[model samples]
Target: MKNLKGKVALVTGATRGIGKGIAIGLGEAGATVYITGRTLEPSDENISGTLLETQQAVIDAGGVCIPVQVDHSDDEQVRLLFERIETEQKGQLDILVNNVFSGVKEIGNAFGQPFWKHDPSLWDAINNVGLRSHYIASVYAARLMNKRQQGLICTISSWGGLSYIFGAAYGVGKAACDRLASDMAVELKPDNITSVSLWPGIVGTEEMFRFSEKWKTEDEKEPQNSTMRDYYNWETPLFTGRVIAALADQQNTMNLTGKVQIIAELAQRYNIVDENGNRPVSLRSLRFIVPSAIPALKKYPWLIPDLKIPWFVLQWTMLQSPKI
Candidate 1:
């Protein structure tokens, strides 16, 4: 990784999971990272990890860390956080990772529960902290980046946006994240700033490992349980972080703006392996017999009409049906 000794980065929700990993990655590359989350102290039990812990971890990795307590759902707090960054860092902001997310806590182990059955507040829980918070952070980040005429804004999204993974709210929020990055890139392009949505395949975060263990014990009788068990090729949160760090160091980051990149594929390109020294399988490679086959079919005009009906019908049904 290129030295980021003087670069400044802010990673929202850096208390745990992907956000924590990314903050650490940036820090490891010598960036002065501002780690933000609601959990300020190590004793805070509201979440699994605390900002102080993540800050310490980053410091241990030979990087500077400034932990900040901010409720990302609060717009004023976010604005004030950026204002402080501007004041402290002399208006230089190099990178922003919009990774705060909620609402999955409400879903719990009921992965396939009908959307309507879920509490209506579930939508607000997701959009408020996940989607809207990202936009709010970006608004402030854009202002800071525009001053320097350079920066990278990465939204940690997933393949869930492209295909149904969990439920309606989660999928919609992720889809919006991708669209946000694409649209933001269009506006930021003139200033040489890049915005991208990253899809990290089945990351084995601490929460996910706990969920996997629970699924194995409780849902062993189900066929989907076997599939879940077989999902061992999970990437570490740091894998995506490493990719982002590498991308930030690239000379031609503008070339990748407005794109949705698959971490697994990028890992192959960047020669990045998980902490366990394993390469995670890309979903496209695993689920499709020939990953490029569907796109190849687009070349044939005769195949278009045949594909359109089933595709349209499936989409219509997905829209009408209650996603659990």
Candidate 2:
């Protein structure tokens, strides 16, 4: 459990949900965790949780916790955060989990709407904190990490980046995030710093639970209605956190630099399971997903052979292929 005992990490936007889970996972691994969020104290806010609450959770998980109230939108505040981390941890920042984003609400509100109908500000709403914030934080982390010539920068991205989900703003922002991690890794490789874009499939976060409300009373015949019934078969927020901890603990981390890591696959690589002690299905795994998604299929788990559409295969299109 103390595999990460001497490690120091920072998780941004960790007041609740995936951020909170990451902190806890790191804490459980015995890492000194610094958590940041706009909400400092417990509030009646609909989104719920706070930096203080997350701090306690980290401590309870057996990891040191430092809570900072920060608005990632403010570059100055972000700069101060890294400066403080450097000062306190003595220039030893082992991990940076870029988990902040402000556009979840906007995406939910305009889910079915087209790009033209959405306000232009939607782009700013999603990418400003999501993509831009990640870039800014990485710059600072790399600076400190380069001093020691080692560190990990993990961006929380999504499958939407590949195909499409939420809307243009969300997908564009995610795709950019993926690119940002890869490009940063390319430059930071010489500095011995690793940057990886992480994709957590169907996280059962607080916000996602709220999003699942509409499916509760839907028609049995509704299209894709049973996909996520209040996070059914979804990975818990802590799932990715565990995978991240393993990534940091691994001696071969540099081998994975500049790559987009799927949490489910990483979980398998690390032999980790969700809080429920079940392996979360990969987005591309037909064998596991079928049984996990439908109750009736659970009886015949082995009927579907293990099969996955690899990332290259999933994205390889006519345009990407060599025109014969």
Best by lDDT: 2
Mark the regions of model 1 whose C-alpha exceeds 4 Å error after superposition: 44-46, 217-224, 287-324
Q: How displaced is residue 33 in candidate 2, in Å?
A: 0.4
**Residue range 102-184, candidate 2, lDDT tens digits:** 88888778866798897899899989988999999998998999999889999999887786667778888998999999999
lDDT of 1 by residue, 33-74 (tens): 998999898663555889999998898888899998999878
The whole-model C-alpha lDDT of candidate 1 against the native structure comes to 0.79
Query: What TM value does model 2 have?
Result: 0.92
Model 1 worst lDDT run, 10 consecutive residues: 286-295
Give the winner by TM-score.
2
Give the TM-score comparing model 1 with the true structure, all chains together. Answer: 0.85
